[model samples]
Target: MHSVCVLGLGLIGGSVLRAVRSAGYPAWGATKSEGDRDAALADGYDVEASVEDALRRAADEDALIVLAVPLTALEEVLRQIRALAPSCPLTDVVSVKGPVAEAVGRILPSVRYVGGHPMAGSTESGWAAGSAELFRGAPWVVTAEEETDLTRWAQVARLAIACGAHVIPATPEQHDATVARISHLPHLFAAVLAAVGAEGGPLAWSLAAGSFTDGTRVAGTRPELVRAMCEGNRSALLEALDEALGRLGAARGSLASTGGLAVTVDAGHEARRGFTATPQAGPAEIRIDLKDPNALDELLDLGTLGGRITSIEDDLAVGEELGNP
Candidate 1:
C-alpha cells in the first residue's frame, strides 16, 4: 500500500493514481507512450511514466498493483507483472471480474490477484480526465474468493475507502451477475434504443429533447468499452438480457390489451410509493417507477425524482413474479 503501480494512464487509471496520491501513498504508473507519461507526471500525480521507475519508486512486494487496462489486456499485464512484481497484491478495475480473475489464476498461478471494479468513470479519457473524486461515494465492488488472502484483501479495501468509495464484497460470479443487471444490460439497451432513434437521421433526432438525451446519454461513450465489458461478462450478461427481454415482451403484451398499459403503469406507481423516498428540496415533484434496486442510489445524484413515484395496481413487480419469464 506504500507505492503502487497503476497500469494504463487513461481516465480510470489516472484517477486511481490521483486517489493514491491523495491517500498519501506513493504511486507510479505504466503507459505505452511517452505522451501519457508526460501527462501523468505533469498532472503532479505521484506517478512515474516507466514501469521500472514506478516499481523502483514503489518498491516491489509491498505496494499495491492495479491493472487499469481493458479486460482484453488483463492476461498480458498479469503475466508481465507476475514476472516483474510477483509478490504485490494485484487487482484490476476491469468491469467484468469473472474473465479477468479466471484468466489470472490460469495464466499466472503464482501471483496474488483479486478482481475489482469501481462503478464510476466519465466518458472522457487521457490524463486530464483523472479525478481524485471519481470514486467518491461510488460502489467499488471487490470480488471475494475462498483462497483469497484476507490481509491482502484488506489492503485492497483500504484503497477503495481511501478513494472515497463505498465498498461491497461479493463472489466473482455474483459480482458478474449483479453488474450485468445494473450496468451492462442497461448500456446494451441504451445503445440499441439510441440506434433506433438515430434511424431517421437529423430530422428524427432534432425532435428528441431532454427525455431522449437522458435516456441514451451513456451510449455516447466509447462503444468498444461497453462491448468489452458485456462480452467479458457474457454468461451473466446473457442471463440478464434474457430477463430484460422478457420484461419488454411482457410490456408489449400489456400494451396490446385494453387498459392493460394503465394497469401496468398503476402497478409501477404503487410499488414506487412504498420503496422510494420523496425529494427533500425540489419545488416541483413527479413520480417515477422505482422497482430497480439501484434507483435510490442513482437518485442521490439526480436533483429530483421529478416527484415521480408509482404503485403497482395488481401489487405485482414485473421481474419479481416471473424470473426471466
Candidate 2:
C-alpha cells in the first residue's frame, strides 16, 4: 500500500492516521483547526498546517488521500482537492454515502472517489478519543457505483483492511439505506429514550441501570454530527423510522387487545435469537428428522440434483425407522 494522507484530524481521522502509521505506512494529516494541528504535531505525527500543502506533499509522495471530514464540510474539501490534486484517487470516512457520492460527482467529476463508512466509533468526539484499534473487527462499507473505479475501490478496501476492518461492498444507495436502519434510526431512538429518561429528573438518573445506560449511550454523541447524519440521509431515515413506528404500533395494539405482551415479546425474542446467533464456520450441514416414508429419498434427490451435497448418512436413524416393512 502507498502512503496515506488523512484530512480532518478528529476522532475518525486521527484513528485512521494512527492505524496507518502503526502499520508502517507513511501517514500525514491535515486539519483546519489550529488546535487540532498543534495536537497532532504534539503527538509526533507529520501533519501539515493547511489542506493545500498537505495535498501538495501527498501528491508529490504518491499518497492516497482519505477525506475524514463531516458530510456538511465535504463539498468544500472536495472542491479544494479538485483544485489541488484532481487526478489522484481518494476515499472518505463519512457516515453518509449517497450525499458524499453526489458531492464528489459534482465537485470532482474526473477524480476517482471511493466512498466508505466504517461501522465503528464511540459517543466521544475529537482527537483525544481516537484510538488505533477503533476500527478493529468492524465492518467498513465501501460504496461502488456503476461507474466506480474498481481499482480505486480496492485501494480503499485495502486501507480499511490495514486498519483491521472487514471490507463490505455496496452501492451508495444500498449503503445509505442499510445505515438508515442500523445506525441513524438507532441514534434517533436513543435520543428519544434519553429525553424520556430525563423527564423523571434526578430520580430517573438514579434509577438508571445497564439497560437505560446502554440503550441511551449513543445519545451522548455530538448533536451536530448526529443531526448532519440524519439530515444527509433523511429519506432513508424516514423510511426506517416509519417501519420501526409501525412495528411498535402493532405491538402496542397487540398488548392492548389481548391484555398480554407475550405475542410481541415472543416474536422479539425469536428475532433477536436469530439475529444474535453465532455464525457457524464451514459448509452448512442439515439433519432431517424424516417422519414420512419417502422423506429420505426426497431430501437425497434435492441435494443430489443441486450437486451441493458432499455426503449422506442413514446410520443416524434407528434400525426400526430405517428398516423396510
Candidate 3:
C-alpha cells in the first residue's frame, strides 16, 4: 500500500485520512485550522504541525498526496505542493474537477496528477462532522483524460476503493458537466426551496413534512462551501441552471393556462423512479486490460455507460456496468 498524505483535514479530507489509515495504509494529514489539528491529534491520528511539514515528509517518504481543499484554496495549496513535493503523485477530493485539473496542469504540470471527486458529503462541515464511512458505496470519479498518467490514475483509484468507493473513470469535463446537474444544481435548488418554504412563515414551518425536509436537506451545508463549489464550475452550472429554469417556466405556464401539472409531475416522477431503479438493478461485469493503448478510452466509455471499477488486479481492471438493464 502506498503511504498517503492529505492536505486540508476538514470533512472530506479528514474522512480520507481516517479511512485511509483504517485501511492499514500509513497516512498522515495537515490542516490550517488549529481546532481541526487539535481535534484530529486528540483522536490519536498523526497530524503535522503545518502543511509544509506534511509536504516535506510526503516528499521524503514518496507518499501519494491527496488535496482535500476547497476550490478557492486550491491555487495556494497547489503552489505549496509544487514547492515542497513537486514530483509527488497527486489526487483531489474537491467537488469540481475541471478547474482543479486545469490548475494542476498549469501549476504542477510535471507532477503525476490524477483528478478525483468523491460524490459523498454531508450538510455539515468541519473535522468534527467527518466520518470514516462517509464515502462507503459512493461513486468516486477519477478523471481519465487522453493524456492522463494511467499509473497515477490507478494509484488514486486504489485509494478511493480503499476508502470504500467505486471508481468511475471520466474526463474532467464530463465529470463537471454531470455533477453540475446532479450535485451543484441540487444545492442551488435546495437553497431556493428552503428560502421559499421559510417565506411561508410560522404556519409553513409547523406544517413542513418529509418532502420539504428532504428537498431542502442540502441547504444546511455551509454557505461558503456551497458557493465555492457552485462558482468553481460556473460554465457547466450555467447550462444546467438554464435547462432547469426552462422546465420550471414551462411548468409554471401550464399551471397558469391549463390548471394542471400532469406533464411536469409525471416526468419528474418517472425520472425519480428511473434514478432509484438503476442502483437496484444487477450490474454486468466489465474488464479492461491496462496494457492496452486504448485502455483509458475504454474506461471513460464505460463510465459514460455508468460502469464502476470494483478492483484492479495486476494490469487488469475488473468492473461492472450499472446503467444498462
Candidate 4:
C-alpha cells in the first residue's frame, strides 16, 4: 500500500502507523485530541484532523484505513467507513474481532474491512505512546471474511512482515474465542490474584512470592484498557471463565484427595519442571506480546527469534502443557 490512515492515535494504533511509515508506506492518523495529534506528529507519525479527512486524504491511493480505537468505538468507526466510497481498504486493531466483523458486515456492504490484533501492547497509551518498532517480532493476527479483498489482505500481510511480526490467520469468531482464553482470561485471573493478595492488607503483600508476582503481572494493566477488553469480549470471556473454573475445580479435587496437599505439591512440582527443560527450539515459534520492548529485544538477542515452525529439538516429547489458542 502507498498510504494508510490509522484512526485513534493511541498505543496500538500509533504503533502500527509508525511501523507502516518505517515500512516505507506513507502514513497518517486521526485523533480527537489536539494534544494527541501533536504528540503523534512529534513522534513522526502523520496526523490527520479527522476520520473523514483521513479517508479523503487517502482517497484514490492504495491505502488502508485502520481504526485503532477501542472495541467500544468500533461500531461508530465502521459506520463512518461504511459511508465512505469503496476505493481504499479498511481494517481495524480492536482486540476482539467477532463483534467488530459482525458490526462491519451489518453496516458496510462494499467497505472492505479486515480485523486484526497485534499481539503486543504496553502499559502506556495515547498518541504520546507511539513507536514504529513497537510491534517488531510480535504476532500480527489477521481475521478475514470470505468477501474480504484478497489484494488488501496480502497488503496487510506484507505490512506485518515489514514490522517483523508473524502472521496468523483465523476467522473473526475464532480470534475472539482464542483471545478470550489466552489474553482476556489471563487478565481476569491476574486481577483476581492481585485482589486476593491485597485482601489481607500490607502484610499479605509482604508475603507474596515469585509465583504470585508472575501470575498477577497483568493485574497491573490500566483500568480503562482492561475494562474495554473484558466488556468487548464478554461472551468469550464468560466461556473462558467457565473453563478456568473447571480447571480450578480439578485442582481442588486433587488437593482434596487422600494424599491431599502432597498430591497438590507433586502436581505443582511437575508443572514447574516443564519450564526447566533445556531450552530447545520449541516445536513452534512462541508468538508472544511484549508490554516492554526491552524485554522482547533481550529475548531476541538471546537467539529466541520467533516464527520458526518448531524448536530445533522436540521439547513437547516430554509432555509440556500445551498453550491453546
Candidate with maximal TM-score: 3
Q: Write the per-residue lDDT of candidate 1 for residues 235-297, one digit (tens) a residue.
A: 999999998788777778877765377655776588668447553443433232334444333
Clashes of each: 19, 0, 0, 6
**Candidate 2 local lDDT, 146-246, one digit each (tens):** 57655565577677877887656667787788889878998999999999999999999998999999999889888988998898999899999999999
Q: Is candidate 1 or 3 superior in TM-score? A: 3
Candidate number with the higher lDDT (2 or 4): 2
Model 3: lowest-lDDT 10 consecutive positions = 274-283
Predicted candidate 3 versus true structure: per-residue lDDT over 64-160, tens digit per residue: 9999988888999999999999988999999888888889989998889999999998877789989999999999999998788788888898899
Better structure of 1 and 4 per lDDT:
1
Position 22, candidate 2: lDDT = 89
Candidate order by decreasing lDDT: 3, 2, 1, 4
Off by over 4 Å in 1: 46-49, 52-61, 200-203, 257-259, 262-275, 278-325
lDDT of each: 0.70, 0.78, 0.92, 0.70
TM-score for each candidate, following the candidate numbering? 0.77, 0.82, 0.94, 0.80
The positional error of residue 319 in candidate 4, measured at the CA in angstroms, is: 26
Candidate 4: residue 155 Cα off by (Å)? 1.3
lDDT of 3 at 322: 78
lDDT against true structure, model 1: 0.70
